[model samples]
Target: MSLDTTTAMPTNGRPIPDPVPNDLTLPQSVDVVVIGAGIAGVCTALELAERGLKVALCEKGDVGAEQSSRNWGWVRLSHRDPREMPLMVESVRLWKGMNERTGAETGYRQCGITFSVTTDEALKEEEDWAQILQEYQIPARVLPAPEALNAFPGLTAPIKGALYNPHDGRAEPQKASPAIANAFRMLGGTVHQNCAVRTVETSGGKVSAVVTENGTIRCSSVVVAAGIWSRLFLGNLGIDLPMLKTTGTVLRTDPVPDGPEGTFKFQDYTFRRRLDGGYSISGPQTGLYEITPDSFWLAPKFFPALKSEFTRLKFRFGKRFVQEMKLPRKWGATDRTPFEDTRIYDPQPDTKAIDKVYAQLQAAYPAFQGVGIAQRWAGYIDVMPDIIPVVSSTEGVRGHIPGLFVASGLSGHGFGLGPGIGKLMADLVTGAVPVVDPSQYRLSRFSDGSKIAPMEGILRR
Candidate 1:
């Protein structure tokens, strides 16, 4: 299979620069092939192309439709895993200039991120994190309750205080992914959405081509950036990853006269003040549980009491969740057909959850007292058992495969760390000085009898 590098206008309406003759076909062989169209894949392609390498990036779905777009858009420098801080720090820099890089409105904001704590335990943990961040010269501090209220002016709830990181901010993940993908195309890279890689063709123990539904793309190297689906790709090469899908629910409020001017996180979930005077809130990033279709049925088997209440109270189940529960248990493990309806897993707002979230928000900040609930949606994210991302090449796979790489297992931090990981992966692919040490994210670490401990809940955050 060859790429007919004809500069045809994209059906999606994004402009494509004219393709040169050499660009018309995939090189009989290429320098690299990247799988997954999310941040990691596009970023790596852009970086490699910038360094003068021929790269091809393919995706099983539209870019960022999964964990990348499904995340709570916090681009903060606070509450980072020490190992991931370098990436976090550099991500903030890239985020600040993302518009120039992608030529798109990504909703980037540097309004700062505040973590409100009401207990001595949470406060102590915040203090500890402050010390570690300061060690890296990252600005972080625990503000007094009075000062916190003064800073935000609308935080009316009673609490000990809050930890503030001025360098932290956010962007609209919904728009950023596509924007970056467009940027990658403009930079002389190739991206194929709805194109799934069937298998990595290898010869003499080296990757020779990426067989996709469209055609065979011969390339010496491949990078796997598929989010939760990354493990499935590696499985094709005989590698098993301890990654799972975790669901999160979020709610939006009707445009109000006023709302919190910035973003906030508390015991129940975090709330981000939207540009439209509404707000978005979600569950704790670490609280999602392992739930299979059977788990819904198993929820009753495991906790008959909750099941009884679910039936007795007529507790509502999100449509997607209910449908997912009806599917065979194997569906979660084996369903691989990629759909174009981007909303295959898109969920409607949970009224009950929204009411609870609204109450909590009102309790935490009174300004939300009369905020009318407008809409809500839910999404799933990829999570590692240990909650640390495992990113590296598969062992025993070499040669043409030598250039193959991986940058996934984001474990709910994809939106926040996408830019940083993208930058680092790009560096590794181009063989340039890495933005952050790769050893921290090497996949072999977990197999070599060393395990990275999961974040200590709010303490580590």
Candidate 2:
């Protein structure tokens, strides 16, 4: 298929220049065609290409232009859902060796992560969570007041204790995905940027090809890792994916001397040091939800999650509500879809929230009082009703769409879980032994009469 050479508008977040040139010609056919060039997509392509399968990765925008690059760069297993703990464990293991495996600096570092607490109730909650981690042989522990202070020196505020994980880590958000994509390219995988896939074409009730704005490519399997755009993409194929989006704002500070060496999440804010000597900071618990048509349609499925995280999510209705209402939910393969309309989901940063977090950071640690803001931006996160990702195939069921697999709905945790999830996805596609049990992340859970709720005592951060 002949491809287009149009370049997308420059993304607004941290700049991640193209690390590898995109493939201009779409192959006539491949063993597997993965849609969306985010971390999951590239990782999946890399795994398949390394396994000697012809792979093609398609992206509507630049790699990691959305949540992958806009995140706080935390690769942690400190306070994960119990169901996701195993996957996170494997993900951290992959992250530790990612730079060597990919031959690119992913900026991964085992700097540890700490959650500070100021009250006995909060400390008890951390202690309870630590007990769960112990069952998995994860080396996470709770420190008492004196010990917590000594572990995290330079704290002016008094704290009862903290939950510390020495193995938790961080990676450069802008560098990780592109590095993996480059690795895939080195392994003979094809990547197409500014190539928005309009719809997947099926034949004989099975996968056949995908129709992109550029053209069509035949394949036996397809993996949709389009992040926030996954719901709309699947909806076009008559699939009801229960997903909603929340906007998260963040800011980077000028390189300041002697900031916290490790990632830290206190009562009001979170911050982690960058490789460039600056610090990425944001409100650990703050997120803005813009009401949309899907918000009402999927409310029942998300009621439990909404109630559990009500204190952290701020609701608003304005341009976003009107904008989403006007977006076409269904489109033909030949049509110009919303994916082309907005190449990247770049939302305006909530200055109110960013400033509030900055103020709290200064109040909690006086060292941040003189830090200068370098840049501020916002990205939308796609969250599932259960706050867990769906990583299953759509085959052999009633009215099944064979050879279709989804690895989306990461719920703001994609960056840390990308490598492991990608490896698992490659196994699922090729019918090999999975790296971790895949039953918990099955897509059928939403429709199979299973009770959906966040794991007990899971941290919102």
Candidate 3:
């Protein structure tokens, strides 16, 4: 099948009004230059600006135009990787107070999250994951069959049990990064849209400045939060970042009352009630992994992860292979890069998979039988080998690029973990004490002979 490479701005379920305008003049110098205007970049800039540091956030396109807004908008911690639990714990706290801090409506609400299981084996998995939650003192409970059915009504299937996290929540992906960017501007931070950073300029083996498509911006430090483009950007610097992309398709329905209040994941279908009174739905175990040149090159490193997720991921080959082959990996600052060609990475939705999910949803809940599909869209998720994120500095890592930090490769958890990861990146960039231990997220784990693997649990998005 031919891939749809249409270069249009992503339709993020809801319309984002009154975007923060870009700074007309790029500052000659700033304390830090953050690449990519996704949630991670915006939040990092906000934290740094609040610390009285001059920071500039440069994006290839509009803020949150990519996976930041294209996600399922779930802010959950019920089934997190144990290594990321602490950071997620802190992230939920940050999310609760985000509206007051940013003075913007992020649409965050703690309506709770439910992972419904049908089989005895699946129930055991949730129970085991709940033990990890208990270790971290998280208040997630596993409801038995009868109680689970009572907690979530309209379920026609026989649910053995469910893992419930009352503190877990949902946020509007459409409004999150933009609101954070506006908040960053309020704190005296610079935001540059349509500005693609070609490469980082090094001075004495440290980041000195960045050459964007608009112009050069001198800075002492740089944070690479470029979501799917981080690997390519770092590749030009001779740094091998083991990152890959997977396409996630989602659809939203018109305002349909009588739906479940919180986010829910059944055997195959997953959904969350939108603030707009509609429901955002997708398949819990469905996504496409378009085979690219990187697939072969990074296969060895991603072997464990591939085996772990073999049941969920589907492999395909087509235009994505050719498009990635045509992407200029080692571009000079003067050359027009692919980032400029595709301002926003809006992939076509998997209509077949979406139809299957919608059918399953209606079959499970008769209330949704008449729900009308309002919109459907897809985005690429920047996945790391271990299916976790790397939020670390380059101080002691191999390649040891000083004055540089990265908070990318969030797998699919960037939206929920953005704020906490941003705070951690700020702490690393400013040489302040970090909020969580940063050893697990070091970039060298892939190269240092550490066994890279995903934690045992149902993958949550």
Candidate 4:
């Protein structure tokens, strides 16, 4: 595949093996209807099925087609918010046994992840944060400058030290979600592709079912793991979910036999070794935000986050503002919604940004000098106001729509935290023992008098 930055469906990305899709035949009823077939949705369905709950996994497009597969495939516990630390710890644990649990290959490897810092201040911050990881008894430690650079070969990026999390690793993005979805199907879960869920039908403020483009499925509960489309989908239901999107561009290299082992975060760029022998590379440009109509409407909630990352994020206007304005905010259940309109949020990769990151990667690691660029792509990341996720039910609001649970706004941490989120969501839905304490991820935090803000400071890695 030629690394055409403008291509929407880049062929280089691991194509999720198309399974026996059930979009043609809609199910009559299910215990739960999971909207979106990303990592979180698929794993949630699988967990629900494992608990013997009939689940219908619906997606506007193919499984893992969006940010689920478009992510850097990094499964890490380093540099995470303390609120999510426990969940990430649980997520990493789930990641370890995913291949066996799904009876498929997820390309999971615990080779380790090294987050290098170029300054002593950053190193000190990381070291201070290591205390929380130590509380969890996670195998994470701070290494001195000399020892840090030695963790990965050819890591010539000028750095003072690093926080090495040997337990933090990666899984193949393209393969993991699809494999899990396939396993869910084998477990008797209905997998629907190209089935755009228009809206959730509520009865007396409780979710009665979800109306999809195909037909209505009488589900007791609905989990909106709709990634970037969550806020839009919820907006039609009168739920004011304060969320926004940021573009992330990633480039994959051709097979590099001697690429640095595991994942490494340079001062400007980051790379992870893939199963196919190539390395997925990205840089700070991932934080770029496009100005849309929602940006102005939700500016008050996001003002703090924007101010915190003023110098870090790049914002663009014009096209996105007009594009989002054209999207229907109020649609009837019988009408075609925007979910069907935009099957995949495939943004154009910034060619110049990719070139710059590539140049910097070669400069840092001379071993990557002549490696061929196989493919480059970009996807939008849905973020929340407090820079965390909402994996709770809809009963927190004034209108209080019951039987509706949401697991969206994972920001950029969805792929890594998918399993933990799924397990926790299933626990909440099934009234079973939670995988972790779900207090921090409640939907009420935004509406309640609780000071809705980011627990961690700027530049959340």
Candidate 5:
């Protein structure tokens, strides 16, 4: 659980050569060109390489520098869309066994996840989710407020009830990301960091080459897994992705005696079981967000429903922070950058937002009242209009674009289910029977009138 700052530096600076490739003048060809080095891209490349494919993984920033490393490391399946449940289950399995497979410490812990609830309606919803889990034979149960309090002796938040899932867990996103990327390299996959791929060449409706700042590299297949920047990468094909940006501002406090002693879970509105000894808490709230329409450069489609949602979220922040006077709260935004436009946005953590979050944290956790504040920052989570991932190929784009595949639109839920989606992508590419029905995630779902009805409490806030 130690935080090592050294591994993060490679994401910046000049382009580096692939570990296996010595000649720099763009390799003539590869079986697959995987774009973006985050969880989605790295997982996809690792899966593909495991299938014996020659894979090339590219990244514009440091590995996992974006949302991959900048997320709450909760690996739980409670309150997920029905369609995504299977993927979440499989991802949990992968996460549980990742350390053995990759030989890297990922800080994976099956400590389970708990959602503290204050209202009867929310409890009913939790019961409903329990039914869903029961049907799937997944271990889920409702823990009443008193029971939850007993589970976490020091949890002082006022709670009427809570939901617990024994099978769910957590992992260090920062550690897991690079571990998986390194696993991909061990599988003979080539990774190119700080190598911004610009244009992709297509002929007869298939991808023929991928053009980056360094030069053109021949590729039969391409996977655009560039988190929030996915739409920008596809813009060259005149395709406007219906992706949006959601911001999450998180902060860390100085290690405290009761740090890792609290519940190894998170409450719905605020709080998470930090792997680094101390608990990290946030208001049970989803922060600011914006959507992209038909153009990457176009103004965001501010979904009107979110305003009221933010209001309630603000109330939650105030309520939670009012009780805990020690925790600090930080805040910031996810950006809207095209792949070639990384220079257009700021990668630095938002200090202003961090200060705000610090104030909120101080009010929430008693142990955090006089604790020294540590690091804090923000990251963008890409959301779809329907708030689901778009995993199938680009529709109506012609024959395979040869190898141009899309596995994005995670809608802020990417980290938890990333490994499973990557495995699914590999199965499709390798002509293996898919583990789950991917039809639910087909790219056409958006335009084909198969919208994911918005979760009442999700989008509006």
Candidate 6:
């Protein structure tokens, strides 16, 4: 099948990529039932299937329909929370080989990334983080003022310095997960789209099987990489995963030649060179926080996270509050779930915010002056208190639910971190040695006495 998504925006109105045909026949048994076909779930299933495990990959919507395909697509290692450095290093390695492994166009390019700092305080913060990277033996350096300004062509912004990592990269979000999922299918794995797993049926405090909308799938274990819907899914299993959702608006411009060599970030906005010659632009810190029921419910737990992200966020309380307020917390297997009702969690786009960021991009870089926006979109990014992901077993903390694993609360960095988390989760499920240390990503950090905090100065994803 010819893949033609040139005009598709992966938003609500436009058609997203669906290269991976749905596997309608649900198998009676599989060694693992991987829930949610976003990057996390799809990559995890691909890893397990490659390891000779019978895996069933299930999704409430098409693969990469939600945040997976709707992100800024910056596969960077700069300014990451120190805890994620190891996994990010692994992710970069996996990304380097993703196209070769899948035999598909993932648009993975090691074009480098620059976290530009226009203020002295920001430069100092960037220097501190660069030191952390140095300690980790990661090649990240803070460039001086003139060096930073000269690095990005057609630049007019007075940037003091920047933390640059040449090994960082970018990828096409619309193609990554689907390519990996197609590779999984070619390997004889099964995929079920529009399949909402209502709950995991447990036996003797351990997971026995997963009951989906279509039928039951008997599996030894289940991995929930359900993205924004993970908290709700876990709530049904009597497990609580504290999460808050933020809306990030993004737009792609018409192809502009010689804008910049790679991805560049300013305080107000971020722009990356896309594989299509166009640039994906968005406000990095201008994430709009839509008030929901979870905001108040998880306030105490998320207070510190909010404090760090407060300056970069804009708040609004409207219909989304009511929409989330009415969602049922618990539901039976046969009953209809919020997941089935909303296959694509495409929220309303904040065009005004996006337009403001676009104006800034044009002012800083002259190449974007006359570029027309090809498409504009938005997505709800789930965030944990630590602004990182929880890629651990359910039994890690309280043994509340055995035979279950979670890879959620990725904040806005899920797209870049997906493959590494997928590989890590697969290792945990099979009882194999992990690719990186998983202690920082444990779900028990909230309940346990671990000092829950974001990396230096509490940065947002």
- Per-residue error at 244 for model 5, in Å? 1.2
Task: lDDT winner between 1 and 4, please give it.
Answer: 4
What's the C-alpha lDDT at position 63 in model 1? 67
- TM-score of each model, in listed order: 0.80, 0.94, 0.94, 0.95, 0.82, 0.95
| Per-residue lDDT of model 2, residues 1-461, tens digit only | 11112223232344453466889999999989999988888888888898899999999988878788888899988788888888898899899989999999999999988888888988889988788788878788998767665644666657788898888889998889999999999988999999999989899878999998999999999999999998889888888778999988888877878766778877788889998888889885558888998889999999988888887888988888889899998889878999998888778887667878887888767668777776777888999998998887865333358899999999988889998899899999999999999998988888888999887556354
What are the per-residue Cα lDDT tens digits for candidate 6 across 280-398?
Answer: 89876457898888899999888888888777788889998998889999889899999999988887667777878888879877889878777777888999988889998986465
Among all windows of 10 consecutive residues in model 1, the one with the lowest summed lDDT is 11-20
The C-alpha local distance difference test score for the whole of candidate 1 amounts to: 0.65
Candidate closer to the true structure by TM-score (higher is better), 1 or 2: 2
List runs of model 5 lying over 4 Å from the truth. Answer: 1-26, 261-269, 284-286, 290-364, 396-402, 456-461
Q: Tell me the tens digit of each residue's lDDT in model 1 across 220-239.
A: 77888877666656765666
lDDT of 2: 0.84
Candidate 3 lDDT, 170-264, residue by residue in tens: 99998889999999999889899999999989899888999999999999999999999999988888887899999888988777887778778
lDDT of each: 0.65, 0.84, 0.85, 0.85, 0.66, 0.85
lDDT at 393 for candidate 1? 64
Residue-level error in angstroms, candidate 6, position 333: 1.1
Against the true structure, what is every candidate's RMSD?
Answer: 8.9, 5.1, 3.4, 2.4, 8.5, 3.4
- Most TM-score-accurate candidate: 4
